[model samples]
Target: MSPCCNWMWGLSRRLVLSGRCQLSARHNVDVHRSFSSVPHPPRVCVVGSGPAGFYTAQHLLKHHTEVLVDIYEKLPVPFGLVRFGVAPDHPEVKNVINTFTQTAQSERCGFFGNVTIGNDVTVEELQAAYHAVVLSYGAEDKRELGIPGEDLPGVYAARDFVGWYNGLPYNRHLNPDLSSDTAIILGQGNVALDVARILLSPIELLKKTDITQCALDALIQSHVRRVLLIGRRGPLQVAFTIKELREMLHLPGTRPRLDPNDYQGLGDITKDLPRPRKRLTELLVKSALEEPTEKDATRWSVAEREWSLRFFRSPIEILPSKDGNKAAGVRLSVTRIEGTGDNSIAVPTGQVEDVSGGLVLSSIGYKSIPISQAVPFLPKQGVIPNSMGRVKESPGLYCSGWVKRGPVGVITTTMSDGFETAQAILEDMKSGNLNCSESRPGAAAIQKLLSLKQIQPISFSDWEKIDAVETARGLEIGKPREKILDPQEMLSVVSN
Candidate 1:
C-alpha cells in the first residue's frame, strides 16, 4: 500500500481503539457503553449502489472512524452504470469495481440489493433509521427529442440501446431492428460513437466481449453499412472526445467519412483553443486533410462499413415510411454557427435536407427523475435542489452524482462529487447540526421492516453468488460473463 493508504488505515485503527465517537441523531446506540455493547454505530444510508454511492461511503468511512454505512440498490447486482452503461470494449474503466467491492467488504459497511427506495422503503423511513441519508441514485431517464415520428418502431434512445447490449435487466427486450442499410445517430458525443462502433464492428470482435448474446446475434445479421452522426453544432463543437474519435477512425475494415470543407478554417483557430479542444480539432483537421495511405487504401477496398460526422444539422422530424408506421428517414434543418468559441449558438438557416435512414438512435443526453415526493427535485434542471451536498429544507438529507448536479461528467467527476458530499456531512456532524441524541437503529431496524414486508434483500454475499453463476455461464460460452438480464433470474441465482 502507498504511504497515504497506510496512514488512513492506521488512523482508522486508532479511532476504533479510542472509541470516542458520538452517535448521530438517528443512531440510538449508547456511546457511553463499550463499543461492543453498542449494536449500531453512527450510521449513514446511501441510496443507489453505483460509483457515486460507493465513493461516498468510502470517504465517510475513511474520515469518520466509527460510522456504519448501508448502501441500497434497486438491482440485485451492483456497479450501476459501470456495468450497464459503459461500452463493452472498455473493460479498463470497469476495474474500479474492485475498489468498490473492497469498500462493500468493510466491516462497517453493508449492501442491500433489490431494494427500491420509493417502493421498498420511503425517504422518511431511511431518514428515521440512519443519522444521514445520502441520495446517489443516478439519472436513469433519457432526454427525448420531442420530434414527430420519434415514437416510431425503428426509433430508439441511445440509453436503451446501451442498456440492451450491456445486459441491463430493464432493456433485455429491446430487440431493435438492424435490417436497415443506413443508421442515423442524433448526437456527436462519445455515446453516439459507441453506438456507431457497435453497429459497424466485426461480429468476431464483439463475440469476445460481454455484450449480450441476443445483441451479438442481431449485429451478426445487421445489414447496416453506413452510420451518420448528426450534431446541431459545428465540427469544433462536437461533444465526443479525441480518444473515441481516434478509435472510430482506426477501426479495422472501416473508414471515416469526414468532409474537408467542414474543417477548412479550423487550423487557424486551433492554437488558441483549450488543450482538449485544441487536440481534438487538430486530429479532426489532420484526418480530414490526409489522403488514404497505400495500406489504408487496400483496407478501404474491402471496407464493409463507414461512419460520418454531420455538423450544423438539427433534426426537425423523423420522416415515416409510406405506410406511416415506421421511421424511414430524417428531415434536418440546416444551421449556421453564430459568434465563435464555446459560446457560439446554432441558428437555423431555413434550408431543409432529407437524409434517408432506416434506423435512428437519439443520443441527446440523460435526465434525473424524482425518486419520491420527499426529495426537493428541480424538474426543470432534472436535478435535486441543494446547497452544496445538503438538500434544501431537508436536514440530514444529502445528494451526490448526476442527481445532485446534472447528467454530465465521467466517473472521476462523480467520485469528486461524492467526496465533497461526504466532507459536507462530516462538517455538519462536527458542527452539531446533525443531532445524534435520538437513537437510530440503522440497518437492523430497516431489515426488520423489510422482513415484515416479506421483501428479501440481497446481501453482498448473495450478489457474489449471482456473480459466480454469471462468470461460470460466461466461461461455458468463451466470453467474459453472461449477465442475468432478468431481475427474477438474478434473484433465483442468489436463492439457489
Candidate 2:
C-alpha cells in the first residue's frame, strides 16, 4: 500500500482506540480499501490565492496521492499578499512566489484567477462540486479608528497607503499628499514602521525599488522631514518584531529620536523578559541610551530626516486645518498602563495633547469580512468560529489562515495553519467523515458556471503572459517589475 494508504489504515486504528470512530464489519472493509477502492479521487477547491490558499493546496496535493486541488482567485494574478502586500524593498519575502508557482504548476492542481466567490458563485455551489472546500481568502478589510475627523482629506488608512505603494489596483490612485513637513502614524507595529521608512527613505534609495511610479513621484516631491509613531502602550508592548525595529534603527539618511525618559530602568528588567523580547528591549535601550559608533554619530549629525516613537498616546481625533477640510494635527489622549507585561491594558489618563501634522496614517490592523452569507462568521471577533480548521456544523467545508484564526502571526503561522486544515480533511477521509464516495466535477463545474455568467477565468499561463509584459516593462526602468496597476489592464494582458 502507498504511504497515504498506510496512514489511512493507521488513522482508522487510532480512531477506533480513541472511541471516536467505531470500525464495524462494513466500516472495516471500507476503510481498508478507502484509497484504492474509491471510484474517483477526492477533489478539493481552495478559495483565495494568497499564502494560506497556496499552502493549503500544496499540502493536499503532496499528502494525498489521488487528490485534485483547484485554487480560485478573484484577481487576475496569483500569490495574493506576496504580490500586493509585501514591501517593495523586501524582495526576499516575495521569493515565496517561487514555491507557490511550483504548486500551481502541478498536474493535479489548477489555478483560476479573476473569479470572485460571492459574486461568481456561492459556497453551496462549491460544496456541491468538490469533496472538500477550503476557504483561505485572507483578511482584506481594514479596521477604522472611529475617531472624529477620521474622514479628513489628509488622513489615510495604512492598509490603503501600503497598497498604494505596493501596486494594489484598488489603491493605485491613492495619490497621498506629502507636502507637509511632519507626519504622524497612529500605531507602532511593523507596518507603521514600514510606512515611516518609506516616507523618510531618500529618493535615490527608492528609485531602485518596485514601489509604484506614482508613489515614487510623490515621494520625490515630499517635504516631510519628520515622522512620529504613536502607540497606546509602552515599549514592552510594541507590536513590531526585532528585525523590523533594527531596520528602522539602521535606516540610511535618518536618525532615531527615542526619548531618554522611555528607556529608564528598561535594562534592569531585560533579564526577566523572554528571549525575543529581551533582545528587542536590549536593542531599544542601546539605541536610546548607549553611545553611537563614530560612523553613526557622523551620519546622525548631518541627517536631514528623523523618526520618533511616542508611547502612551491614543488618537481621539484628527484635528483639521483653518479651512476645516484637511488634517492639521492629531488629538491624542494620554494613557497609563494598568498591568505588567505584554498583555497590559492602556487606560486613559484624562489628559490630552495635540501633535501637529498634515498627514495621518492609521496602522492599527487588518480585518476579515464575511465573503458569503452561507459561511458562519463572528463579526465582533472578525473570524469564522472553527475548531481545528473544520467549520462548525458545516461538513465538507473548512477555512484556514486569518479567516480561521484572527489576523495575527507571520507567513510561517499561516503555513502551519494551512497544514492543520489539510490534515483535518485527510483524517475525515480516512474515517469516512467526509463523503468522497461521489466524484465531484470540481473546477469543470465551476468553469461551466462561469461560462453561463459570461465571465472568463484567467489561467496560470495567462498570468505568465501578463508577468512577462510587466517584467519587460520593468527592465526598461531598472526595476523588478512594473506591476499592472489596473485590473482591467491585467485582463487585457491575459486576453492578448
Candidate 3:
C-alpha cells in the first residue's frame, strides 16, 4: 500500500477506535524498542483477543505517537469471534482477521495468549506493570431459560451447542444425541434461528463452513426433521437477521416453509432496519411469491424446502419421549401482542398448546462470567464497569468488547469500542495518569499456578498451527475447514 493509502487507513481507523495501545512506527533503520525514562512510551495490556482487543491495539499504533501494547487471552488463538463465533462459511466476514493480524505485527504490540487473567495474572498486577490494561474478553456462558428440566439429558443450551460445533474451548466437549427425530429451540433472537437452521440443514450443506468434524458427522447421521423453534414474542419481534434467515432457504435437501399467516403480522421493528433485514423482507416475500432472482444471492436465496419458527409462545414444560429421559416435545403458553412487535413490542396471549420434538435448545442470550475474585470485579451485570472505556473502580484499568459494552452488537461494534478505549488511555497518559508500581501478588498459591509448565499460554503462532491443520484437512474434504473440538487435542497441537 502507498503512503497515502496507509495514511487513509490509519486516519479512518482513529475515528472509530478507543481502547489499548500507543503508536510508534517501525524504525526503517531497525530502531530498538526504548523505555526507562520519563519520556518512555506508554505500555498497554489488553485482556482478550476479540475484535475489540485487535482494534484497540491498531488505533493506538496508527494514531497515537508514543506507546506499546500487549493483548492477553485465555484461548491459544487470536480473532476471538472471527475464529469461534462467526459462521465459518462466511469467509468474507472472517476477512476482518487480516486487518487484526497487521495490527499485532508491531514489535510493541504483544499478544499473551492462553493466560487466564485472574489465574496467571491479576487485575492489580496489570495496573502496576502496564500503563493501562483493557479487558476485551467476550461472553461465553449461555443464559438459562429459568425453567424446569432445562438441565436434563435431552435438553441443551444453544450457546453450548453452537460452541460445540464452532470449536469453542468452553463447550467443545458437548456430545449431543443426534439420533432424535425432532428438535425444539426457544427464543426469537438471530442466534435462535442460527441454531434451528444448522440443526435442520444437511451435513453436506454444513461442510462448507468451519464446523467441527465431529459435529458434521453427527449431523450427517442425525435423524432430526420438523425442527420447532419457539419464541416468546411474535414474528415482528423476532430477533434474527433476515440475511441469515434467507440463507436457511438455500440449505441443500432440507425443507423450509414459513407459515403464510406469519407474514400478516410482521411489526415495525423493521420500519427502518438495515443490513440483512431490508433485503431479507424482500426475499421472504419474493420467495413466497415465487419471484426470486440472482441478485438475491448477496444475502438470501429461495429454499428447495424451508424450516419455520413459531411466535408468541413461551416454554411451559418439556415433555419427555415414550422411553423416558429423551425430549419428546414442549408444552407452551401462548402470549398476546398488545401492540406491533417491532419498534413497540407486544406478544400474543392465548391458550396452552403442545408441540412435538425430540430435542430442546434454549437460545435466550449470552453473558460473560465474572472472573474469579482475585482482581477488580463488578458486583452486578457480571462485567467490569467503565466510562466509555475506562474502568470506573480501578485506576490504570480499562475494558472493551462484550465484557466492556455488555452482551450485544456485532463484531464490528467491538472494533469501534476498542478504538474508544485506547483513545481514553492515550488521553490519560498525556496527562501523566499512569501508575507503575511493583507490588507482587503475595501468595504461594499464585506462585504454584504460574510455575505449572503443563499450562501452555496460546499465542498468535500457536493459533496459526491449529488453523493451518484445520485448513489443510478441509482441503481433503473440499470444505471450508474442520475444527478440533477437544481441548487436550488443541493444546497438544499448540504445544507441539
C-alpha TM-score for every candidate = 0.91, 0.92, 0.81
lDDT of 1 by residue, 1-496 (tens): 2458435433432333222112122222221224433454577999998889999999998998778789999777999999998899888899999999999988788888877788668999999988999999999899999988899999999999999999987788989999899999999998999999999998888888899899999998999999999999998898889999988988888988899999998899999999999999999998898787788778877898999999999999999999998999999999999988879999999999999998999999999899899888899899999988999999999999999999887899999999999999999988989876567878767766765555666678878988999889989998889888877667656655
Give candidate 2 misplaced runs (Cα > 4 Å).
1-38
- Where model 3 places Cα greater than 4 Å from the true spot, the runs are 1-39, 265-305, 338-350, 372-380, 435-456
Candidate 2, lDDT over the whole model: 0.86
- Which window of ten consecutive residues has the lowest lDDT sum in model 1? 19-28
**Superposition error at 266 for model 3 (Å):** 5.0
The per-model lDDT (C-alpha) reads: 0.86, 0.86, 0.68
Residue 400 in candidate 1 has what lDDT? 93
Tell me how far the alpha carbon of residue 249 in candidate 1 is from the true structure, in angstroms, after superposition.
Answer: 0.8
Residue pairs clashing, model 2: none
- Candidate 2, residue 397: Cα displacement in angstroms equals 1.1
Q: Which 10 successive residues of model 3 have the least lDDT summed?
A: 18-27
TM-score-based ranking: 2, 1, 3
